[model samples]
Target: MARWEIKNVRIAGVAAAVPRNVVYTTDFDFFTLEEAEVFNNTVGIKQRHIAPEDVCASDLCFAAAEQLLADLKWERESVDVLIFESVTGDYKTPPTSCLLQDRLGFSEDCFSMDIPMGCCGCMYAITTGGNLLSSGNAKRALLLVGDTALRMGSMKDKSRVPLFGDCGTAMALEYNPTASDIVVDFHTYGKGYEALMTPHGGFRRPITKESFEYEDFGNGIVRAPLHTLINGMNVFSFAISKPPRSIETFMADYRIDRERDVDYFLIHQANKMIVDRIVKKLKLPLEKVPYNLEEFGNLGGASIPSLMVTRLRKQLMTEEKSLLMSSFGLGLTWGTMWLRTQPMVVSELVIL
Candidate 1:
């Protein structure tokens, strides 16, 4: 029998990247709360980080990866595999993970690949990488996910244009059977793809000037152009419904109590309302969920990792806490993972 129940890989380290450019809610003229009732009704978003126009999603991933590797004292050559999950990529051809491997000066022996998913990519990456390491094929792994999707639109689309901010996050995972407390499950609904996605630039819809025509999903709500049609209602419904189911599924399988066991619920940061609805539906206490949206907005794949980094900085997470983390979003993808926090040593130079 396996010495472990396949449930004992601790989180080694985590780091995240946000662009240097900070844009406050007041930066937009017509979109400002003072100017538009809709903006005011939706609530002020505070501030968000915008990547330099020249930077791409892979660049942000590299930045965060550098920080994470340094923080964990992981030598580039020691990384056996690199799993990069992202909805946005530098381009459709070369895998972003491979590009990052070269950018970060890693040995060619490293296994580099990319898993293309939207909001759920972070959880999926963690679950996948953890399993890979547990198999003992790879001892150490770097999981990086980020997006520069903010640049996906022109100045005309106000809804998604400002709400998204660029960010990248990396998690370092190491195999350790002695600790023995990791659980993960990743799922997807391909049918939900049309509900929230950048419908262009892929093989299906080649990028063209005419692809920029915007479409309204009823109720005078105009979202991105035809190339990118995101149905907020459908997306919201799925997000709210799926996360609780996922959590219930995990708890049932592991025979763990939800209320008594989970100390924190590190959910993906798609938006405030989405999170509120899920938390309510799950019947989880408000204090259990961490909030980074109020200050950073939604960083997509980078949400959970960034939130972890913030919580770690505040000493809010400790070895005693049992965390139930879930991520949901575009691609209609979602997943949940459970793990017991454990002490992991690191160099002081990591988070700078």
Candidate 2:
């Protein structure tokens, strides 16, 4: 792999937006204990937030960007490029990023595009923004991610309904002139596609009322017998093996140790069980892993950024901290990135 030289690129700010409405685990009372037991085994997800029927992924993303820009005190003009990552986009055409850019009042000269890569979306977005900055194509970039897969499912597909939620997160990347300050690495695996996917609703099988009523799969969540198929076991097996292997490989390749080296492990908030599994396998301390799944559930691509923003606002994060972030699952994709924290704001000094 050829290494690219990057100068002073720092994550200037971060923010996340979760829907006001949240669905609790108790909401699953509709499912029998036996059926729910089959679903909850290994893969631990109790509750997830769902966007209102009319709310699109872009809505969550835009709200997140608004809060992020305001918190950073950054003008829209400072953003030269924007990337929106989502599988559940606002539309099939007219990339969601375009709508978001306008909504955020970004300048006309800014370049905007959308990437639809599911769970790996955030990693791809981060890498995209980093390259855009290092290439001098843009001075600063905004990487936004959001998804509402749960709302996209039919009412009958209760299996996936409780696992996904609507959320949006934003990260600001700035170009710096110093070479040693900013560095990054990435890798991906796409062989895991069939292991997880929305079974219907696209060019292959158009939606129809009949499709909605069909129950060939013995489940009501189908348009033409639609089932949000997921091999829970496969996903967990790959997640456990892949994430740790990648992290260890990257650390060894970079010659870094966990003790006195990296400051944080910001894994995607996939679920409590998966998060805990990886944490135990890696033998990483709880403090090293910053998570908020209990409060927000799985926000898909928005998980990592949302956690970062929440921690920062709570004054739980500090300057010059080294954060190691890993993203995995969906498309069977995964990657690890090292970041240095340079907070956008400092504390206020008040007289007693």
Highest TM-score: which candidate? Answer: 1
Q: List the candidate 1 regions with Cα displacement exceeding 4 Å.
A: 1-8, 32-44, 213-227, 314-318, 345-352
Worst 10 residues of 2 by lDDT: 343-352
Backbone clash count, each prediction separately: 6, 4
The number of residue pairs in model 1 that clash at the backbone is 6
Candidate 2 matches the true fold with a TM-score of 0.87
RMSD of each: 3.5, 4.4
Q: So what's the TM-score on candidate 1?
A: 0.88
Off by over 4 Å in 2: 1-6, 32-46, 179-185, 204-227, 312-317, 345-352
Please give the CA lDDT of all the candidate structures: 0.73, 0.72
Give the per-residue lDDT of model 1 (tens digit) for 328-348: 876677788777867553212
**CA displacement after TM-score superposition, residue 250 of candidate 1 (Å):** 2.9
The 10-residue segment of model 1 with minimum total lDDT is 343-352
